[model samples]
Target: MLQDLEAKALAGDAEAQALVHLLRLLRRKAYQEARAYAEGFPGELRERLLAGLSLLEEAPDRLEDPLFAAEREVLLGVRAVGEGRREEAEARFQRALALDPYHHRALTNLGNLYLERGEVEAALDLYQRALKLAPDDPLVHENLAALYRKKGDLDRMVAHLKRATRLKMRPPVSLDPLTGKPKRSFRIPLWVWVSLLALLAYLFLKKP
Candidate 1:
Protein backbone atom coordinates (compact mmCIF):
# COMPACT_ATOMS: atom_id res chain seq x y z
CA MET A 1 0.00 0.00 0.00
CA LEU A 2 2.83 2.42 0.79
CA GLN A 3 4.47 1.33 -2.47
CA ASP A 4 1.27 2.19 -4.27
CA LEU A 5 1.24 5.56 -2.50
CA GLU A 6 4.78 6.20 -3.67
CA ALA A 7 3.81 5.36 -7.23
CA LYS A 8 0.82 7.70 -7.04
CA ALA A 9 2.94 10.44 -5.51
CA LEU A 10 5.47 10.12 -8.34
CA ALA A 11 2.66 10.29 -10.89
CA GLY A 12 1.50 13.78 -9.81
CA ASP A 13 -1.11 13.03 -7.14
CA ALA A 14 -0.94 16.01 -4.80
CA GLU A 15 -2.33 14.28 -1.71
CA ALA A 16 -0.07 11.27 -2.23
CA GLN A 17 2.86 13.60 -2.70
CA ALA A 18 2.17 15.32 0.63
CA LEU A 19 1.65 11.98 2.39
CA VAL A 20 4.92 10.69 0.95
CA HIS A 21 6.66 13.73 2.35
CA LEU A 22 5.13 13.12 5.78
CA LEU A 23 6.23 9.50 5.73
CA ARG A 24 9.73 10.55 4.72
CA LEU A 25 9.88 13.01 7.58
CA LEU A 26 8.59 10.39 9.97
CA ARG A 27 11.46 8.06 9.04
CA ARG A 28 14.13 10.77 9.15
CA LYS A 29 16.05 12.20 12.09
CA ALA A 30 15.16 15.83 11.25
CA TYR A 31 12.91 16.79 14.13
CA GLN A 32 12.44 20.45 13.16
CA GLU A 33 11.44 19.66 9.61
CA ALA A 34 9.09 16.91 10.68
CA ARG A 35 7.43 19.01 13.34
CA ALA A 36 7.03 21.96 11.04
CA TYR A 37 5.48 19.81 8.37
CA ALA A 38 3.16 18.14 10.85
CA GLU A 39 2.11 21.46 12.39
CA GLY A 40 1.37 23.03 9.03
CA PHE A 41 -1.01 20.43 7.70
CA PRO A 42 -3.95 22.51 6.46
CA GLY A 43 -7.46 21.14 6.95
CA GLU A 44 -7.93 19.43 3.61
CA LEU A 45 -4.36 18.22 3.40
CA ARG A 46 -4.52 16.84 6.93
CA GLU A 47 -7.74 14.95 6.31
CA ARG A 48 -6.58 13.54 3.00
CA LEU A 49 -3.24 12.40 4.39
CA LEU A 50 -4.92 10.90 7.45
CA ALA A 51 -7.22 9.00 5.13
CA GLY A 52 -4.21 7.76 3.25
CA LEU A 53 -2.69 6.56 6.52
CA SER A 54 -5.91 4.83 7.48
CA LEU A 55 -5.80 3.05 4.15
CA LEU A 56 -2.46 1.56 5.13
CA GLU A 57 -3.79 0.24 8.45
CA GLU A 58 -3.93 -3.42 7.43
CA ALA A 59 -1.94 -4.92 10.28
CA PRO A 60 -3.47 -6.56 13.36
CA ASP A 61 -1.71 -3.98 15.55
CA ARG A 62 -2.71 -0.89 13.62
CA LEU A 63 -4.97 0.41 16.35
CA GLU A 64 -2.02 1.17 18.61
CA ASP A 65 0.04 3.24 16.21
CA PRO A 66 2.43 5.47 18.13
CA LEU A 67 1.87 9.19 18.12
CA PHE A 68 4.32 11.37 16.19
CA ALA A 69 5.41 13.19 19.36
CA ALA A 70 5.99 9.89 21.18
CA GLU A 71 7.98 8.53 18.24
CA ARG A 72 10.27 11.56 17.98
CA GLU A 73 10.92 11.71 21.71
CA VAL A 74 11.72 7.99 21.77
CA LEU A 75 14.11 8.44 18.85
CA LEU A 76 15.85 11.25 20.71
CA GLY A 77 15.99 9.12 23.85
CA VAL A 78 17.59 6.27 21.92
CA ARG A 79 20.25 8.58 20.49
CA ALA A 80 20.93 10.05 23.90
CA VAL A 81 21.43 6.58 25.36
CA GLY A 82 23.90 5.79 22.59
CA GLU A 83 25.79 8.97 23.52
CA GLY A 84 25.83 7.93 27.24
CA ARG A 85 23.62 10.79 28.36
CA ARG A 86 21.75 8.54 30.75
CA GLU A 87 19.72 11.17 32.59
CA GLU A 88 18.51 12.89 29.44
CA ALA A 89 17.70 9.55 27.94
CA GLU A 90 15.62 8.56 30.93
CA ALA A 91 13.68 11.84 30.85
CA ARG A 92 12.98 11.47 27.16
CA PHE A 93 11.73 7.93 27.52
CA GLN A 94 9.57 8.91 30.47
CA ARG A 95 8.04 11.79 28.56
CA ALA A 96 7.36 9.57 25.59
CA LEU A 97 5.67 7.02 27.80
CA ALA A 98 3.63 9.76 29.49
CA LEU A 99 2.34 10.73 26.08
CA ASP A 100 1.69 7.16 24.97
CA PRO A 101 1.56 4.54 27.67
CA TYR A 102 1.70 1.71 25.18
CA HIS A 103 4.82 2.93 23.38
CA HIS A 104 6.72 -0.35 23.39
CA ARG A 105 10.21 0.96 22.65
CA ALA A 106 9.91 3.73 25.19
CA LEU A 107 8.86 1.24 27.82
CA THR A 108 11.71 -1.13 26.98
CA ASN A 109 14.33 1.63 26.98
CA LEU A 110 13.11 3.05 30.24
CA GLY A 111 13.12 -0.41 31.73
CA ASN A 112 16.76 -0.63 30.76
CA LEU A 113 17.36 2.66 32.54
CA TYR A 114 15.82 1.35 35.76
CA LEU A 115 17.68 -1.90 35.46
CA GLU A 116 20.94 0.02 35.16
CA ARG A 117 20.06 2.03 38.24
CA GLY A 118 19.41 -1.17 40.23
CA GLU A 119 15.68 -0.57 40.50
CA VAL A 120 14.87 -4.21 40.12
CA GLU A 121 11.13 -4.11 40.79
CA ALA A 122 10.42 -1.15 38.50
CA ALA A 123 12.52 -2.63 35.76
CA LEU A 124 10.80 -5.98 36.07
CA ASP A 125 7.35 -4.43 35.80
CA LEU A 126 8.28 -2.42 32.72
CA TYR A 127 10.01 -5.38 31.12
CA GLN A 128 7.03 -7.62 31.76
CA ARG A 129 4.67 -5.05 30.24
CA ALA A 130 6.93 -4.66 27.25
CA LEU A 131 7.20 -8.40 26.79
CA LYS A 132 3.46 -8.69 26.99
CA LEU A 133 3.14 -6.27 24.11
CA ALA A 134 6.00 -7.76 22.07
CA PRO A 135 6.19 -11.36 23.17
CA ASP A 136 8.23 -12.59 20.20
CA ASP A 137 11.08 -10.08 20.50
CA PRO A 138 14.19 -12.10 21.40
CA LEU A 139 16.12 -9.10 22.65
CA VAL A 140 13.28 -8.22 24.99
CA HIS A 141 13.30 -11.81 26.18
CA GLU A 142 17.00 -11.52 27.00
CA ASN A 143 16.48 -8.22 28.75
CA LEU A 144 13.66 -9.69 30.81
CA ALA A 145 15.87 -12.63 31.66
CA ALA A 146 18.56 -10.30 32.92
CA LEU A 147 16.03 -8.37 34.97
CA TYR A 148 14.86 -11.61 36.59
CA ARG A 149 18.42 -12.50 37.41
CA LYS A 150 18.87 -9.14 39.12
CA LYS A 151 16.11 -10.10 41.52
CA GLY A 152 17.39 -13.70 41.93
CA ASP A 153 14.39 -15.26 40.19
CA LEU A 154 16.33 -18.08 38.61
CA ASP A 155 13.29 -19.89 37.28
CA ARG A 156 11.97 -16.92 35.33
CA MET A 157 15.45 -16.10 34.09
CA VAL A 158 15.92 -19.62 32.77
CA ALA A 159 12.49 -19.57 31.13
CA HIS A 160 13.18 -16.34 29.27
CA LEU A 161 16.64 -17.52 28.25
CA LYS A 162 15.19 -20.71 26.84
CA ARG A 163 12.52 -18.77 24.97
CA ALA A 164 15.18 -16.50 23.52
CA THR A 165 17.22 -19.50 22.43
CA ARG A 166 14.20 -21.16 20.84
CA LEU A 167 13.40 -17.99 18.93
CA LYS A 168 16.99 -17.67 17.75
CA MET A 169 17.11 -21.26 16.48
CA ARG A 170 14.07 -20.88 14.22
CA PRO A 171 12.96 -18.67 11.38
CA PRO A 172 10.64 -15.87 12.52
CA VAL A 173 7.26 -17.18 13.56
CA SER A 174 4.23 -15.81 15.37
CA LEU A 175 2.39 -18.14 17.70
CA ASP A 176 -1.35 -18.13 17.99
CA PRO A 177 -1.94 -17.47 21.69
CA LEU A 178 -5.37 -19.05 21.71
CA THR A 179 -4.11 -22.37 20.44
CA GLY A 180 -0.37 -22.05 21.20
CA LYS A 181 0.43 -23.03 17.63
CA PRO A 182 2.85 -21.40 15.22
CA LYS A 183 1.28 -19.58 12.32
CA ARG A 184 2.22 -21.39 9.13
CA SER A 185 4.46 -19.71 6.63
CA PHE A 186 4.15 -19.73 2.87
CA ARG A 187 4.98 -23.33 1.99
CA ILE A 188 7.36 -24.69 -0.59
CA PRO A 189 5.59 -26.82 -3.18
CA LEU A 190 5.59 -30.51 -2.07
CA TRP A 191 7.50 -31.66 -5.20
CA VAL A 192 10.38 -29.27 -4.43
CA TRP A 193 10.70 -30.60 -0.89
CA VAL A 194 10.63 -34.20 -2.07
CA SER A 195 13.33 -33.60 -4.70
CA LEU A 196 15.54 -31.79 -2.20
CA LEU A 197 15.20 -34.58 0.35
CA ALA A 198 16.00 -37.22 -2.30
CA LEU A 199 19.15 -35.33 -3.36
CA LEU A 200 20.25 -34.96 0.27
CA ALA A 201 19.68 -38.72 0.92
CA TYR A 202 21.73 -39.70 -2.18
CA LEU A 203 24.63 -37.44 -1.12
CA PHE A 204 24.50 -38.76 2.48
CA LEU A 205 24.60 -42.44 1.27
CA LYS A 206 27.59 -41.60 -1.00
CA LYS A 207 29.56 -40.04 1.94
CA PRO A 208 32.04 -42.08 4.02
Candidate 2:
Protein backbone atom coordinates (compact mmCIF):
# COMPACT_ATOMS: atom_id res chain seq x y z
CA MET A 1 0.00 0.00 0.00
CA LEU A 2 2.80 2.42 0.78
CA GLN A 3 4.55 1.61 -2.48
CA ASP A 4 1.33 2.06 -4.45
CA LEU A 5 0.65 5.32 -2.69
CA GLU A 6 4.19 6.51 -3.39
CA ALA A 7 3.75 5.69 -7.06
CA LYS A 8 0.49 7.59 -7.25
CA ALA A 9 2.02 10.43 -5.28
CA LEU A 10 4.87 10.64 -7.75
CA ALA A 11 2.28 10.72 -10.52
CA GLY A 12 0.73 13.85 -8.99
CA ASP A 13 -2.29 12.38 -7.26
CA ALA A 14 -3.28 14.70 -4.41
CA GLU A 15 -4.95 11.99 -2.36
CA ALA A 16 -1.90 9.75 -2.80
CA GLN A 17 0.34 12.58 -1.75
CA ALA A 18 -1.65 12.96 1.47
CA LEU A 19 -1.50 9.25 2.08
CA VAL A 20 2.22 9.29 1.47
CA HIS A 21 2.61 12.09 3.95
CA LEU A 22 0.66 10.21 6.55
CA LEU A 23 2.64 7.06 6.04
CA ARG A 24 5.86 8.97 6.21
CA LEU A 25 4.81 10.49 9.51
CA LEU A 26 3.90 7.08 10.88
CA ARG A 27 7.18 5.65 9.68
CA ARG A 28 9.09 8.47 11.38
CA LYS A 29 7.19 7.95 14.59
CA ALA A 30 7.88 4.24 14.52
CA TYR A 31 11.55 4.81 13.80
CA GLN A 32 11.76 7.21 16.74
CA GLU A 33 10.11 4.70 19.02
CA ALA A 34 12.42 1.96 17.91
CA ARG A 35 15.40 4.21 18.41
CA ALA A 36 14.19 5.05 21.88
CA TYR A 37 13.84 1.40 22.78
CA ALA A 38 17.15 0.40 21.20
CA GLU A 39 19.60 -0.99 23.77
CA GLY A 40 23.34 -1.74 23.79
CA PHE A 41 23.96 -1.87 20.02
CA PRO A 42 22.49 1.41 18.85
CA GLY A 43 24.51 1.81 15.65
CA GLU A 44 22.17 -0.42 13.67
CA LEU A 45 19.00 1.37 14.68
CA ARG A 46 20.68 4.75 14.21
CA GLU A 47 21.74 3.86 10.70
CA ARG A 48 18.31 2.53 9.84
CA LEU A 49 16.52 5.59 11.16
CA LEU A 50 18.97 7.93 9.46
CA ALA A 51 18.51 6.12 6.15
CA GLY A 52 14.73 6.40 6.42
CA LEU A 53 15.04 10.06 7.37
CA SER A 54 17.28 10.77 4.39
CA LEU A 55 14.73 9.18 2.06
CA LEU A 56 11.86 11.11 3.55
CA GLU A 57 13.90 14.30 3.38
CA GLU A 58 14.03 13.84 -0.38
CA ALA A 59 10.32 13.15 -0.85
CA PRO A 60 9.23 16.77 -0.88
CA ASP A 61 10.58 17.56 -4.31
CA ARG A 62 8.19 18.13 -7.20
CA LEU A 63 9.53 17.55 -10.72
CA GLU A 64 9.30 21.17 -11.79
CA ASP A 65 9.91 22.76 -8.46
CA PRO A 66 12.72 25.28 -8.41
CA LEU A 67 14.30 23.65 -5.37
CA PHE A 68 14.00 20.18 -6.87
CA ALA A 69 17.51 20.11 -8.28
CA ALA A 70 19.08 21.28 -5.04
CA GLU A 71 17.00 18.83 -3.03
CA ARG A 72 18.06 15.99 -5.31
CA GLU A 73 21.68 16.92 -4.89
CA VAL A 74 21.30 17.04 -1.12
CA LEU A 75 19.59 13.64 -1.10
CA LEU A 76 22.32 12.16 -3.25
CA GLY A 77 24.90 13.63 -0.90
CA VAL A 78 23.09 12.12 2.07
CA ARG A 79 23.05 8.74 0.35
CA ALA A 80 26.76 9.04 -0.28
CA VAL A 81 27.26 9.81 3.40
CA GLY A 82 25.32 6.68 4.27
CA GLU A 83 27.48 4.62 1.91
CA GLY A 84 30.70 5.83 3.57
CA ARG A 85 31.55 7.98 0.56
CA ARG A 86 32.64 10.92 2.66
CA GLU A 87 34.52 12.78 -0.06
CA GLU A 88 31.65 12.35 -2.51
CA ALA A 89 29.16 13.46 0.11
CA GLU A 90 31.32 16.45 1.00
CA ALA A 91 31.55 17.52 -2.64
CA ARG A 92 27.80 17.14 -3.09
CA PHE A 93 27.11 19.07 0.08
CA GLN A 94 29.49 21.82 -1.02
CA ARG A 95 27.66 22.08 -4.32
CA ALA A 96 24.35 22.26 -2.53
CA LEU A 97 25.73 24.89 -0.18
CA ALA A 98 26.98 26.87 -3.14
CA LEU A 99 23.48 26.79 -4.54
CA ASP A 100 22.09 28.01 -1.24
CA PRO A 101 24.69 29.15 1.23
CA TYR A 102 22.19 29.30 4.06
CA HIS A 103 21.05 25.71 3.72
CA HIS A 104 21.08 24.71 7.37
CA ARG A 105 20.64 20.97 6.83
CA ALA A 106 23.55 20.81 4.43
CA LEU A 107 25.68 22.83 6.77
CA THR A 108 24.79 20.70 9.78
CA ASN A 109 25.42 17.42 7.96
CA LEU A 110 28.72 18.68 6.61
CA GLY A 111 29.74 19.56 10.14
CA ASN A 112 28.82 16.07 11.32
CA LEU A 113 30.79 14.55 8.47
CA TYR A 114 33.81 16.55 9.50
CA LEU A 115 33.35 15.49 13.09
CA GLU A 116 33.26 11.84 12.02
CA ARG A 117 36.50 12.36 10.11
CA GLY A 118 38.26 13.76 13.19
CA GLU A 119 38.34 17.26 11.80
CA VAL A 120 37.13 18.85 14.99
CA GLU A 121 37.96 22.45 14.11
CA ALA A 122 36.35 22.17 10.69
CA ALA A 123 33.33 20.55 12.22
CA LEU A 124 33.09 23.31 14.78
CA ASP A 125 33.24 25.95 12.08
CA LEU A 126 30.54 24.32 10.01
CA TYR A 127 28.37 23.72 13.05
CA GLN A 128 28.80 27.33 14.16
CA ARG A 129 27.75 28.50 10.72
CA ALA A 130 24.66 26.31 10.92
CA LEU A 131 23.87 27.54 14.40
CA LYS A 132 24.10 31.10 13.23
CA LEU A 133 21.41 30.25 10.71
CA ALA A 134 19.35 28.03 13.01
CA PRO A 135 20.33 28.54 16.60
CA ASP A 136 17.40 26.54 17.88
CA ASP A 137 18.22 23.33 16.02
CA PRO A 138 18.72 20.76 18.75
CA LEU A 139 20.36 18.19 16.50
CA VAL A 140 23.15 20.61 15.71
CA HIS A 141 23.62 21.32 19.37
CA GLU A 142 23.66 17.62 20.20
CA ASN A 143 26.23 16.88 17.50
CA LEU A 144 28.37 19.72 18.73
CA ALA A 145 28.06 18.33 22.23
CA ALA A 146 29.27 14.94 21.00
CA LEU A 147 32.27 16.59 19.44
CA TYR A 148 33.05 18.37 22.68
CA ARG A 149 32.69 15.16 24.59
CA LYS A 150 35.20 13.53 22.27
CA LYS A 151 37.65 16.36 22.82
CA GLY A 152 37.36 15.91 26.60
CA ASP A 153 35.82 19.33 26.86
CA LEU A 154 33.18 18.52 29.43
CA ASP A 155 32.21 22.15 29.99
CA ARG A 156 31.29 22.76 26.37
CA MET A 157 29.63 19.37 26.20
CA VAL A 158 27.42 20.24 29.09
CA ALA A 159 26.57 23.61 27.57
CA HIS A 160 25.59 22.16 24.23
CA LEU A 161 23.70 19.31 25.90
CA LYS A 162 21.76 21.85 27.90
CA ARG A 163 20.86 23.70 24.72
CA ALA A 164 19.79 20.45 23.08
CA THR A 165 17.67 19.55 26.07
CA ARG A 166 16.10 22.99 25.98
CA LEU A 167 15.08 22.37 22.40
CA LYS A 168 13.26 19.22 23.56
CA MET A 169 14.72 17.01 20.85
CA ARG A 170 16.92 14.78 22.99
CA PRO A 171 15.04 11.97 24.68
CA PRO A 172 15.76 11.67 28.38
CA VAL A 173 17.38 8.26 28.31
CA SER A 174 20.20 7.38 30.65
CA LEU A 175 21.29 4.93 33.31
CA ASP A 176 18.76 2.90 35.22
CA PRO A 177 16.61 4.80 37.67
CA LEU A 178 17.62 2.47 40.48
CA THR A 179 21.09 1.04 39.81
CA GLY A 180 22.65 3.62 37.48
CA LYS A 181 23.32 0.91 34.92
CA PRO A 182 22.36 1.46 31.31
CA LYS A 183 18.69 0.76 30.67
CA ARG A 184 17.19 -0.92 27.64
CA SER A 185 13.51 -0.18 27.43
CA PHE A 186 12.60 3.50 27.23
CA ARG A 187 9.23 5.19 27.16
CA ILE A 188 7.53 5.74 23.81
CA PRO A 189 4.20 7.16 22.83
CA LEU A 190 1.28 4.75 23.10
CA TRP A 191 0.21 5.41 19.52
CA VAL A 192 3.62 4.35 18.22
CA TRP A 193 3.32 1.04 20.04
CA VAL A 194 -0.18 0.54 18.67
CA SER A 195 0.89 1.28 15.11
CA LEU A 196 3.92 -0.96 15.36
CA LEU A 197 1.88 -3.84 16.72
CA ALA A 198 -0.73 -3.34 14.06
CA LEU A 199 1.87 -3.34 11.31
CA LEU A 200 3.48 -6.46 12.71
CA ALA A 201 0.12 -8.21 12.84
CA TYR A 202 -0.66 -7.24 9.27
CA LEU A 203 2.67 -8.59 8.08
CA PHE A 204 2.24 -11.79 9.99
CA LEU A 205 -1.28 -12.34 8.65
CA LYS A 206 -0.09 -11.75 5.10
CA LYS A 207 2.84 -14.16 5.34
CA PRO A 208 2.80 -17.14 3.02
Query: Which prediction has the highest TM-score against the true structure?
Result: 1
- Quote the positional error of residue 205 for candidate 2 in Å: 66
Model 1 residue runs over 4 Å out of place are 1-67, 173-208
Model 2: lDDT equals 0.65
TM-score of 2: 0.51
Compose the digit string of candidate 1's lDDT tens values, residues 21-121. Answer: 66544433333444445445678665543543443333212323443555556777887999999999999889877775656677888999999988988
Which number leads on lDDT? 1
Q: How many residue pairs clash in each candidate?
A: 0, 0
TM-score, candidate number 1: 0.52
Clashing pairs in 1: none
Off by over 4 Å in 2: 1-64, 169-208
Tens digits of lDDT, candidate 2, 100-189: 565667887888888887999999999899888778778788988998999999999999999988888646554432222358886898
